[model samples]
Target: MTAFPLLLLALAILSEVTATVCLRMASAGGGRWWIGVVAGYLTAFTLLAAVLAQGMALGVAYGIWAAAGVALTAVISRLVFKEPLTWVMSLGLVLIVGGVLLIETGAAH
Candidate 1:
């Protein structure tokens, strides 16, 4: 029960990150690639709703998903788009991960 919602939340976030990457790629002359971006976002939101439908608490699920999404999207941006990554960015990602962990742990209680 819990695992299912969490899985869907993670998938939603990942899809969102993928969508953002695809959007950036499209903007950089990857013609018609925006379609992928649009589709990704659509899928992300749909999956997000499914997570909620599975009984995930809205605050916990949404917060964790957003934080994880931002961290992962940044990582993907650096890897797939060759975007610059600084020490600050790495530190920020770590903090985001930590924060998300804390939130999830709290929610468990």
Candidate 2:
């Protein structure tokens, strides 16, 4: 994919991750934070839609999106929430990244 579409996908993943983090914080009676949650998800979906308009296949785009979102969310969760990151989880993240790379490369062919 071209840089612009990839950028959109990255933005989508970041937006989703942000929304998830906000939701976690909002769980403690911070109802106002739900606005952020809504905005983030909406922004992400919009960007993802734009990416699809660019002709990226669903399997490749969504596979990369989901993998990056999960890995980034886990790392950020550890930093922001004092969540523990076991070695196994680290391995899982690496595997997720590797799998996404494989999907990306396969899509290029």
Candidate 3:
């Protein structure tokens, strides 16, 4: 997890989160948002592949990417869409962060 791969991973997570938000909007009758959904997902996967090509382990990279995406999407959705953000979901986010940290630590050893 050099800086470059880390940066790509971050970008991938952001792209995925953006795509998910776009999907939500599209489902809620914003048809034009679909283009954003498609483009965001394509960019996300491309950056993910680039991260893998940068020699990062799949499990570690994907674990971090997925966890960060979920966490960010949930928080952003709550803020942007006025969706629920209960204590249980917050706890889940904490757990996801902890899990990602464990995976990253394990990969370092």
Candidate 4:
């Protein structure tokens, strides 16, 4: 993938991860936290659309986006919320990364 679309995809992943984290925070903290959730998701979707418009295949783009989001969210949540990050979970993350890499590479064929 080109740098621009990849950059947009990265941003989209970050936005989605941030939004998911905000959602959890909002559940506990309430109030203005909801704004972060909304803004983050909006930004994420917008960037995702831009990535698609850049001619990225949906399967590849979404695979990368979702896998990265899940991994980042899990790690971030563990750091921020003291949530568990067990060995099994870590293995799953590694597997997810591998899977996304496969999807991305296969898309080139």
Candidate 5:
């Protein structure tokens, strides 16, 4: 299939993960970070809408969005906040990625 939808979906996922990280940062100590939180989420949703308009299937787009967002957010948390990432949680993230891959490949066919 075309890659445009996947591009938009990737943007959506990036925006969402950025927003989530900013939200946590804001809650921690910096109220100014809330600006990033709001902007990131708004951008994310806008990108998501654009993806849908571009004919990306909702199931596939949203699945990839959520899976990638969760996976990236977890990694960011570990790096930025020094949060723990157990092996089990890492495996779960792997499964999420695998599921998203399945959805994408299925949509391609």
Candidate 6:
């Protein structure tokens, strides 16, 4: 836990979510092109694999990564993709964050 790998995993998840949002935004325009989106996702996947190479368990890493990624992607979609934000969506995001917190707490044991 005191290793650089965990940080890398977090970073990879962040980058992955950002890339996903960017991809969505690009698709909305159809004219904006998607080379950046492609590059971002490629980099994200590579970094994720690098973190995995450092011996993190797949289940733990993937669960935290997916949950955090979804929450962050939702936020980014609202901001960058001009997606609407309802109270329900906001509450959902909160629950996702809470669940990820719980999972991480369990991982510490």
Residue 56 in candidate 4, Cα distance off native in Å: 0.8
Give the candidates in order of TM-score, highest first: 4, 3, 2, 5, 1, 6
Candidate 5 ranges beyond 4 A from true positions: none
Clashes of 5: 0
Identify the candidate with maximal TM-score: 4
Please count the clashing residue pairs in each candidate, in the order shown: 0, 0, 0, 0, 0, 0
Ranked by lDDT, top first: 4, 3, 2, 5, 1, 6
Instruction: List lDDT for all candidates, in order.
Output: 0.85, 0.91, 0.93, 0.94, 0.89, 0.78
User: Comparing 1 and 6 by lDDT, which wins?
Assistant: 1
Better of 2 and 6 by TM-score: 2
Residue pair clashes in candidate 2: none
Q: Which ten residues in a row have the lowest lDDT in candidate 2?
A: 100-109
Task: Give a tens-digit lDDT track for model 4, residues 44-69.
Answer: 99999999999999999999998999
lDDT of 5 by residue, 70-99 (tens): 889899989988999999999999999999
Whole-model lDDT for model 1 versus the true structure?
A: 0.85
Worst 10 residues of 4 by lDDT: 25-34
Candidate 6 lDDT tens digits, 38-94: 777788788889888887767678877888888777777777667888899889888
Which residue segments of model 2 deviate by more than 4 Å? Answer: none
- What TM-scores do the predictions have? 0.86, 0.93, 0.96, 0.96, 0.91, 0.79
| N/CA/C clash count, model 4 | 0
> What's the lDDT for residue 9 in model 2?
94
After superposition of all CA atoms, the RMSD between model 1 and the true structure is: 1.6
Steric clash pairs (candidate 1)? none
Better of 1 and 4 by lDDT: 4
Q: Please, what are the lDDT tens digits per residue for candidate 1 over residues 3-106?
A: 88878888899889888888888988998889989999999999999998888878778888888888787778788778888999889888877887788788
